[model samples]
Target: MPTPAGADAARRYPVDPNSRLNVRSGPGTNYQLVRVLPYGASVPVNCQKPGETITGTYGTTDLWDNIANGQYVSDAFVYTGSDGYIAVRCS
Candidate 1:
C-alpha cells in the first residue's frame, strides 16, 4: 500500500536520541531481545501492534512498531509526531 502523503516510505521515525532502543522478536519486553538500535537511529514502521505499555523518552503507550519481520521496538521511544498509530495496524 502507498504510504500517506508527507510520510516517507512507512515514514521513518526518529528514535529517542538518548536511547539505544531495543529491537525485539515480538511486540513487548517479554519477547526475546533481538538487537539494539544505534543511538540517534531512525526507523521505518512497517506496521504496529498493541503490547505491554512502556514509558520512554516520548511518553507512555502499549504501541509497538514493527520495523522488520519479527522485529519490533516500543513506540514510546519513537518520535512519530503523534500519540496514535501512524501506520496500518498489523494483522
Candidate 2:
C-alpha cells in the first residue's frame, strides 16, 4: 500500500501476524536493545515519536535475529524485515 501524506505517514508501520519485526532502541535494529516483540502484542505502529528510533531485529537478517524483545502473545505480529517495522504493545 502507498504511504499516506504528511508526518503521520512516517509514523505508521505495517502490522501483521506474519510481518517480522524487532524491538530495539531505534526504529531499526542498528541501535541498542530494548526487547524482542513477538506476535499477539498490541503494536503501536502509528504512535512513534519523531527522532526516536524504535529498535528491533533485522527480521530478515542474522544481525536482526540476535535481538529479542521477549515473547509472543496472541495479538502480535511477526517482524519480517525492513519491509517490516517496529511496533509497541498497547495496554
lDDT of 1 by residue, 1-91 (tens): 8867856555588999999899999988999999999999999999999999999999999999999999999999999999999888999
What ranges in model 2 sit over 4 Å off?
1-14, 49-91
How accurate locally is residue 61 in candidate 2, as Cα lDDT from 0 to 100?
A: 22
Q: In terms of TM-score, which candidate is strongest?
A: 1
Give the residue spans of candidate 1 off by over 4 A. 1-7
Candidate 1 overall lDDT versus native? 0.92
Candidate 2 positional error at 70, Å: 16
With a 3 Å backbone cut-off (N, CA, C), the pairs that clash in candidate 1 are: none
Worst 10 residues of 1 by lDDT: 3-12
Native-to-model Cα distance after best TM-score fit, residue 39 in candidate 1, in Å = 0.4
1-91, model 2: which lDDT tens digit per residue? 8766664323422345444444555434346656544554334243222232233332232212212233221112323334332443222
Which has the greatest lDDT?
Answer: 1
TM-score of 1: 0.89
